[model samples]
Target: MPEKIDYLKKIRELTQEYFQISLDDIPIPETELVNIEPDRADGLLVGSKEALNYQYLVQGDITPFLNKAPEGYFLIGFWGHGFNSYGFYYSRVEPNSRIFFRLPYGGAYMNNKREAIRIKNFLINFFEFKNKLKTATTFNVVESMGEGFHEIKYKDQTVKFKGSVYRQRNPEKHFQKILKSLKVPTKRHQHIIKLPSWAGKKYEDMTPKEQEEYQEHLRRKFTWEPGDLKKVGHEPLTEDEKKLVESIKKQEEDVNKE
Candidate 1:
């Protein structure tokens, strides 16, 4: 197990080195560090909340931390149980030598999967830019949802396909076709809207004009929903599903009333 004292010391050392400020300079009150257990892998770090807020200010907004980070820098956060936290680390040298700094109450208000996906996507894009300034960088997304784990990788050219889980080792051939269809000058947004699995069959059966209309319909509806179009594409919500959504919305309102 990691020692609380050791982790706190390391955090202080890292913050001083990266931000050029001692732990005392941070805005979070010292008393907040009391419950942090360094030895535990999952426990929060002392002063992490303050450090994260400071980083956002220094970096000129969360974009740098959210998108492609420069080489020698990375952001880490914890998410689960109705909150998301933020923090950043940077390397002074390679191989086990780095600095870690955190922000205060970083996880306080955020609590949802959509928010998590948006944050993660932004960070991945940022990292992609940083990696590309050198040689081409390989982009990978890994998901570990308790029961299963999956990973997908894409080359620099394919970064346009933003949220896709399909790994394309050679995405060049289909690049132009995808670009023309999506009507976007940048490839980075490809993963943003995924066609349903049944889209192929449905698209094939329809006339060219029908396909165009269908594609346009989807372009206007820009929300994220899992499963291919065959299951839950651009079709209107079912009456039952709509009622469930309404019910949940009312429940939310009732909770807010209290």
Candidate 2:
């Protein structure tokens, strides 16, 4: 609780330094950001590794919040791990006309409630200035793991905004990472299917019903059993697996020959 407050204070200080607005000038009162535990209603597994927290500050109305937020924000209430940080949205009305900004994860570690208030004050000023800016400027310092800092310039001033950075993790190269973190078996690799060149020829020659039957057979044989693929130390390949691999090789060979 104290940590949350400290975070608010820091945000307020940053806002004041950048935007020249104090906590009192901001119309909305600071409220505690609450941690909502993931539940079945949220579509999260009972013991999933991810967690979510949300905070809202309303000023004038509720209509803007609902209509203006991006699709991700709407989906936010549904999943836990998709987003892993704390942030706030400001509204001019009871529940509408709001803009949201996601804060870095560590921002939640403020000392006390009063400090959190200060941070909120800082954010409001920063955002207000951000909205008024005309050009963006890069910051000399780097903050989070994948985040970059930038300053946006307005006619009379500039405000800083944090940028998110994402890195692609390869599942094949980091199989251990995926396997170690798995709560349940992974889904089968339907994306990459190996079919023999002869199989394609046969399919083209088959009747529609025969094609349907062939497709069903493939699905039944190749589709993985739930939770089977996620296990570590799984064997190299079974007889069926070998057949699939051979078909894939034949297809590749045909393409190469062409």
Candidate 3:
């Protein structure tokens, strides 16, 4: 119980800092009983390594909190399927429950296109994944999608998708297959950071200066360079090169005139 609370504190703090939140103006989570031996819900099993302690409570447990959340504050919920292929991946934060921003793993697409884009922008700014995020949004970032995904009523409007979403096709069947044994950053969390703890100290906690490293890391992870092979690679000529080309063209013109 204490562990889950502490974990939530760390996650919230990190997320706040990640988003450059000046104040504690965010969703307050409500949790469920999970420490009970042999938890059957498996709600807690779908998050990233850092969220292991709270996964048991993530699934259905957030409803009470959402129901009570004040308007204007977005509700965020976390829950997942199977043993966690990526253990976690990007989740669509929809505004279906006027209560809070539901971050549930099994959540459907957002219906309000404009509002969805607005919320996504805020989240992208908050998560700092704006650079690495590869969403399906075309005209609006919310509508565009990628491969391996399904189309459903995001909120009010109907959405069609050609490729299925990445999360819908996580290959790893069990956590063991996808889990990466990680080392907790320092002695601070030695006691709390146990086996299932993966992201004890990752990009989530990186300070602004430290975030540069993460930014660079993301740039490399999704590295791409502009290319136009069909169009002959055009290089701007220097003044001297430009003069030489012009002179050649002028000489050709002179010959043709003759």
Candidate 4:
């Protein structure tokens, strides 16, 4: 626990130095854990009559249903802990994926206090960064500060068909539309708990181009791991990503000036 606390402390220091956001604008969670699970408690997710973003700024660390974290990020906020550029409060303080890679290793703790010499580790792994830098760089957040959706696009790379059949991974809801039209079947699917009146429409209702675009723009809505895309080669930077990174850097410089 002591080492975990130290690593968390270190995370805060680096975030403050590079995130370039005003600390006052982003308050920290009082502790590493939320007062309670937001979903389990009423009003935790909906909050008061304040703006959704304002509520998150005031109490996001405890809410999960309304969370808009960077794609592929675990963001310790679930446990009320903050790391990298994230504050425990759930606000996207300095939304940079690079902040996640900044941790010395990863996870809640490093080592256990007991054991002769080996001292077994927790988190099911040693709680270290094996390839956090590489993985973190493969994705970026759409915004550093937003009370809205935390949109994320996965970095894509072109791969030649080498005649080796590749197993498929789960695709996003929009992409599933394409598969549905193609008559492909899958046990897994994007589950929408709530359905609006328009939900009555089926995949046949979508135009071909719309379906294709949805599939083409597919992205990850969950965490990333080395095994997930280990074989995918490097992707050339998309024009949008290049621009976003530049804008982030500019903001960093501006914050440094202050």
Candidate 5:
């Protein structure tokens, strides 16, 4: 309970710093909580590795907080790890809205359309996974192996699976297969998939920084250069990449018309 509170406090402080906020202006009141366990309701999770602790919280929908938040304060939440280390992510909501994600002590993606879509998908799947956890007959966590797994018992059968902690490749399809075998309802969490409003904005309206970020996402998504076929071998793109190329073309057309 105290851990969660401390993390939230740190997260708020980091957010203030990121936004260059003056604490005196906001006047944060003392927050009272009847049950700290409810903090996990928003996709928060706790994990331990050796002597360090990890706290993960996903703020899927930040609209409710916007009215009370200080101007230019667009923070959603954070992924806190260890006692002294924490990383925060932010999202924008107005025109040219975007979400920025930072990897732990690594690279970050800014105002990226693909990342926004990825986060949206993750939040949807994650909340549904949390919902599915409630029906399990028994749930246990294991960490002896390299990457730990969960042993979940639903009805007459037991299955072992790993949680999706912002991984690029996940066993969600496999998990869905298990849930299907258990006759689980898949459409119970439509409301939980709320992303920032106006996720895709006009290219001309985007700030210079956001335009760079958008182009970076495209570069990352479509790795092949114009003459890559001659210089280096390239594998055929997946269906998703084809769609992305088409969308990029459409965006260019939209920009030309403007």
Candidate 6:
């Protein structure tokens, strides 16, 4: 048990560094090293044994994890062979998903309009440079396993095609370098929970109606409902959102001047 805890701690640290996010923002989830393949003995009646190879993140839907995110925040995830590969994910107190982008490598499902645009531009430039540089790097040619098209859609960016596949024995190191280069410090605004002024009275002394209202308020405060998107692509920002973004930009500019 202690070993598993330590192992998860390391994984969280890696995720934070690779995703360019803070450790406090990451959520802790029940995890286990799952068996990926079962070793088979030649001409044997049963397989030799199960090999706990893959790092299993979660099974089925990743929505439950994303739903916990706060408004104006988005969740990022890496998509691998299966759904169990998305380790623990979390979001702020509110959530939104206006624009979504996924490469053969996965990306964030973002809500903030300004942030989505910035990341989209970054991804476009990154992949274009990578595609050009790939030919210079050593290539490992292998027989075709199967043919399938990779498609990505978000705003002005869209890609759909079937082509030669690239495989690497250990791609994690290379990916780590790319993420490190793009790493930028971000601050997540914190919320302080406080009871209403009226709630200062003792619970036992409160009126029946007041008690009922207090209970309702508590339920509303604690309950988290999943956010729904009318459409799963890019959407224009409202005037209010635009103003908020302008304010943020001004703050950043001020910080740079210091």
Each candidate: RMSD to true structure?
A: 22.2, 22.9, 23.9, 26.8, 21.8, 24.7
For candidate 1, what is the TM-score?
0.21
Q: What's the TM for model 3?
A: 0.22
Candidate closest to the true structure, highest TM-score: 5
CA shift of 137, model 3, Å: 20
lDDT of 5 by residue, 1-258 (tens): 454355445544754554343333332223331112223333121111210221222233322322332323233344443342333333322221222233232114343344334444444454456457566665543221022345567778776665434444553665577677667666655566764332466655678787667665665555444534121226675554455556666676689799
Order of candidate numbers by lDDT, starting with the best: 5, 1, 2, 6, 3, 4
- Please list all clashing residue pairs in model 5, or write none if there are none: none
Candidate 1 structure quality by residue, lDDT tens digits, 4-87: 355556666755454444545432322333223333235434333333333322223333433443333333323122344333
Q: TM-score of model 5 relative to the true fold?
A: 0.30
Return the top candidate by lDDT: 5
Candidate 1: where are CA atoms >4 Å away? 1-106, 135-258
What are the lDDT scores of the predictions, listed in order?
0.37, 0.36, 0.32, 0.29, 0.42, 0.33
Residue 225, candidate 1: alpha-carbon lDDT: 44
Candidate 3 Cα outliers beyond 4 Å, as residue runs: 1-5, 21-150, 154-157, 162-258
24-117: candidate 2 lDDT, tens digit per residue = 6654423322233443223211110111332221222123333443322221111212344332223221221223333232224523344335
Cα lDDT tens digits, model 3, 1-258, are 453443344444544443343224542333331221115343222232223333223334344333442322321233334543111122322233221122322334433333334333444343332222123231111211222322323223334344322223232221112112211112244456343222233544557665555444333433233321121235553454344344545565689799
- The worst-scoring run of ten residues by lDDT in candidate 4 lies at 158-167
Task: Report clashes for each candidate as comma-separated counts.
Answer: 26, 33, 25, 1, 0, 6
Model 3: worst 10 consecutive residues (lDDT sum)? 175-184
User: Against the hidden true structure, what lDDT does model 1 obtain?
Assistant: 0.37
TM-score pick, better of 4 and 6:
6
